[model samples]
Target: MATAKTRQKILQTFLDLLSEHPYEDVSLPMIAAAAKVKLSDMRSAFASKLQLVAAFTEKIDTAVLDGVDEDMGDQPPRDRLFDVLMTRIDVLAAHKEAVRALHVAARHDPALALDFNRLEVRSQKWMLIAAGIDVSGVKATIVAQGLAVAFARVVGVWLEEDDEGMPRTMARLDKELDKGGSFMKRLNGLERAAKGVRSLLKRISDRPARRRPRADEDDGEPDLSDKAPAGA
Candidate 1:
């Protein structure tokens, strides 16, 4: 129920403070002062510091996804996945401090970890679905999680390195993607297979049932209990 203006002010304050300090060193009072809002107001909007951090992280994720989605028109499936992931890496690299804070907070905050994972999984699924892949099966989920973790590690390395190592780091990812089967292709294949299976099952289930003869139509019922007692 917060006003747009108030939300904008809070976000601006957070960005300003983030540029000047590490995540661990930031406090509510400092953020309020930077945002020109009262500490109570900040607290009212975000229940805790961790929630503020999550909000900031979500804002960054949204911006990156928006940029990728805007530019993904008519691109091939592989290219779209690669482009989106690289764009996200670039965004995180540009906001290294903020990214670092979120990484650190994720280690100590279970809720943050769950939220972050959910966002990541959703984005990956969206990319796969856009590429005409089904994201319903267990295998698809595992593959998506694996790709996300790998991409995250790559981004982490890119953020931690200097200009000299950036090319080498990117080259490594390119080589990895090219040398082995493309992660995007695997995801798409799994999705297609899942869809095919689902379609087959649906078709089978939708077919008309065949009539069978009733038990009463038989000539007679066997008397097995009488025969067994006579065996003694």
Candidate 2:
């Protein structure tokens, strides 16, 4: 329990620092100092800043998953997804500055952007499952990737929209989800088409091969006469 608290403290301290500073400006030593832990102890909890960020992301994912509304089970998939994503934004409201900082850093750093994308896609998969949406097969990954991008845009709007009701943020989210739903329909159609093509090719490949008659061979024709040839 002490170890867990220490880890949480480290993460919290990092977020606080991130909120006040750019991602590039925050360092491991700074987090250790801010958290009042030994540098070695901080290292034991997290090896690097990226890992710390990833751990923070996991913490958020857990919070969102745990808070999933059971009553949303009967809701349409899009509505369920909207609720889940809005819940995420609500949870992230406290750390808005930190998210904004990371967003800015990621725009300039290709490596950071790529790393964050992986984390976003993974978290989006869980969100999809929470919404009772299918996350199976390769198309599921495409769906997740699309959601991640849409969610990022929503977050961008969220950071800029100061209105308490977040009218703009909600509006943007609704629009993105509508676009995503259309894309999903197209993806499903393509997947079905691909499956049909694969089935046809398999059937063709499984067929028995027909052999051609050889030049010197008689083509299974029966002899009319029962007697042997005169030479015989």
Best by lDDT: 2
Q: What is the C-alpha lDDT profile of model 2 across 28-51, one tens digit per residue?
A: 999899899998898799999889
Pairs of residues clashing in candidate 2 = none
For model 2, the superposed segments whose C-alpha errors exceed 4 Å read 221-232
TM-score of candidate 1 to 2 decimals:
0.63
Q: What is the lDDT of residue 49 in candidate 1?
A: 66
Give per-residue CA lDDT, model 1, range 1-232, as digits (tens): 5566777688767666676676657787887887778767787787666566556656656766667664666776556666666666666666676666667666687876777776666556655554444547676676567655666666667756788447756765565456324665676687799899999999999999987768667646675756786658
TM-score against truth, every candidate = 0.63, 0.92
| Model 2, backbone clash pairs (residues 3+ apart or across chains), number | 0
RMSD of each: 6.0, 3.7
Give the Cα error of residue 36 in candidate 1, in Å.
3.1
- The lowest-lDDT stretch of 10 consecutive residues in candidate 1 is 126-135
